[model samples]
Target: MLLDTYGRIATDLRVSLTDRCNLRCTYCMPEEGLQWLGKPDLLTDDEIVRMVRIAVTLLGVKDVRFTGGEPLLRPGVVGIVERCAALEPRPRMSLTTNGIGLARTAAALRDAGLNRVNVSLDTLRPDVFQTLTRRKRHDDVIRGLEAARDAGLTPVKVNTVLMRGINDDEAPELLQWALDHGYELRFIEQMPLDAQHGWQRDDMVTADEILTSLGGRFTLTPEPDAARGHAPAERWLVDGGPARVGVIASVTRPFCRACDRTRLTADGQIRNCLFAREESDLRGPLRDGAGDEEMAELWKKAMWGKKAGSGLDDPVAFQQPERPMSAIGG
Candidate 1:
């Protein structure tokens, strides 16, 4: 197990396939985009699979999520999912995509052993979508979500980030839309992860504000903490019953004590925390002919030094990581 001195064990792994994305969301990057990873710097497909193999077989990682600047943009992404799915004591697998190409590949991805998908979508309005993402592909994202659901990607989750004076007013409408479509809606607070370093605490929409907005339209009953267990989102039963909504208050309500996730960058560096300042290089040693046990040891050591919290609580002391959310594999 990837155990830390704080008595936390990391069983979930987020592997960034590439730092390249098709959309330039204002919250994520500049419109022109940051410099992408050189092909030589990215881990090869084999290396990625081998690392996952070690984590699942040796380190007890039970859940694997492939993220990226946009994971669907990665070449042979389906093949990577297929390879990872073949491991013994198979881990549950999912993808976090911007949903640009998902319509065309969701079925293939599902067939390739991907369990489900979490698509990033901020608004249902086309003009607002374009403004937020700097892309005119709102229709494509809708098509992609439909494709994901139709392809048997059960419990298709939608990840939405509300920016103040932007799409923050659409929370209730978004949740209502999600419930009508059988998709799980998760509203996340905007964090200081943008490349522009322009995020302000006042500019972010808090979880309380979201629930308050929804309260005007519907009743929300909180789900028990046991049901949430290590999950980032604190859920609520909408209008009472099976259908529920979630809010990931990473900023206002940090869930660090029960954190069970470890991250691997596209370049094969281990990130024990999303807001971490340092990374452990596994690619260097892997390319140097390191064995499975050695690689696993490196991963364990990285998690062993995991931070107690994301440190976003202290405004003065908390420094944003040099890498943006895209580069750091949000």
Candidate 2:
């Protein structure tokens, strides 16, 4: 396994296939969207496969999560999933998507070897969704969720980004929706990854608030300490049922100490952390015919420099990453 300076093992890899997205959530991007990289600049399927090969074969990575402005927006996405699934000693593979096209793509993607999925759904209210995403595809996303479940992506995960004055009030309702529909609901504390850089600590509904609110609605109990292990989200059993909910306290309780994932941007830069400011470019070397060993070393060198945390713990010193969540992959 690849060990960072802090003794943490790097076993999870999140790859961004493209920076282009189909929606413009108020907190993630502008309504018009950002200028995307040209086709020539994005990593080709072969290049992405090669990177994953190195991460799994050489670095001992075990899980590969594909992300994007919308991974479904990438043409041949199923092909990409098929390639990753074919890796020797294949890693556990999954995808994080907005679910707009999930209704149409989930089955093919599952057949292509995707393990599970996380769909972003901040609000169940269509009006709020349009206000948040500046788009009218709320029903499409819902259909996507249903498609995912019916396609055998059981216990489909719904990621809800809770903004204090925005959709925070829907937390209880969202969790109930997930419980009733059999999707695992997870509340993510809003972070400063927006392109606008207008993220404020007060605007975030803390994990404590989420737990309290959830407890008010159901007999929520923290998933046993043993159950947590290295998973980023802190889980809790709902009404002691098989169904459960999770909260990723990125803002209030950074899980950096247990983080095992790193990211590869669509433009071919390696990011050690989601909030990492510096990125190491691998595209230059890859295009110059650098072999797998050379690329692996560059990756090792970059990861060996991993910090103890993302710096949110030190509010005075914390700085948001230069890239928005979409460009860096959600």
Candidate 3:
């Protein structure tokens, strides 16, 4: 098992397949998106599969999550899922998507051994969705959700990033919708990932406020979280349905203490922390003929340097390396 200096086991790995996405979500991307990662810098599918194998076989990684500016944007993403699923003791494989392309790829993804998917949909209102994403794809996203369900992606999860004046009022409505459709709904507190994106603490809607707004309409039971990684969300089940809800209080109640996730960007850099300024580049070494053993050593060096946790709430927080959240695979 690869344990970092802070004693956090490397059990979960989030790999970004690409830095390109189809939507321009206000929270994630700027109106004018940042420059994209050059093709030469991005890791090939073979390289990604090799790295994932090493992570699961040598590093004791138990779960593998595929993310991206939009993972579905990556050609042959289903092939990557197939390779990850073939591991000796198959690691739990999942994907996080914007759900724009799920309508066409959900079945293929499930057949390729993807265990689950988490879709990002911040609002149910078409105008609100357009306002938040700068695109009118609310109906498309909804269709993607239904398609995923029809494809046997049960308990499909919808992730909503709640901003104070933007979509906070729709919290109860979203929760009710999730319950009605047997989907898992999660409300995430906004974070300060992009300074240019106007992330303000004052604009965040705390998890407590979200729970209070529900107002005993449904009994909230804390679900058992025996998983090893730090997801930050305190999960609960809404009574009278198979649906569930989660609250990710990143801004108000940080879960850095138990953070066990390591992100591998599409360009092959390992990020020990989301807010970290330092990243160890593996793409250059891999492309230049580095063997798996050599790459494994580099991985250790990066993991060993991880801080106990990121103090993002600190008034004196340092500037994150200029990589936008899209490039970092959120």
Which has the greatest TM-score?
Answer: 1
Q: Where in model 2 is the C-alpha error above 4 Å?
A: none
Best by lDDT: 1
Tens-digit lDDT track of model 3 for 87-204: 8789998889999999999999999898888999999899988988999888889989998988887668888987678788888899889877768898888767763757766677
lDDT of each: 0.94, 0.90, 0.84
18-104 per-residue lDDT for model 2 (tens digits) = 998889988998877477889999999999999999999998999999999899999989998998899998999889999999998
- Cα lDDT for residue 43, model 1? 94
Residue 250 error, candidate 1, Å: 0.4
Candidate 1 C-alpha lDDT tens digits along 1-330: 999999999999999998988899999899994888999999999999999999999999999999998998888899999999999989999999988898999999999999999999999999999999898999999999999999999789999999888899999899989999999999999999999998899888999999999999999999999999999999999998699899999999999999999999999999999999999999999999999999999899999998899999888899999899998887
In the order shown, the candidates' Cα RMSDs to the true structure are: 0.7, 1.0, 1.9
Compare candidates 2 and 3 on lDDT and give the better one. 2
TM-score of each: 0.99, 0.98, 0.94
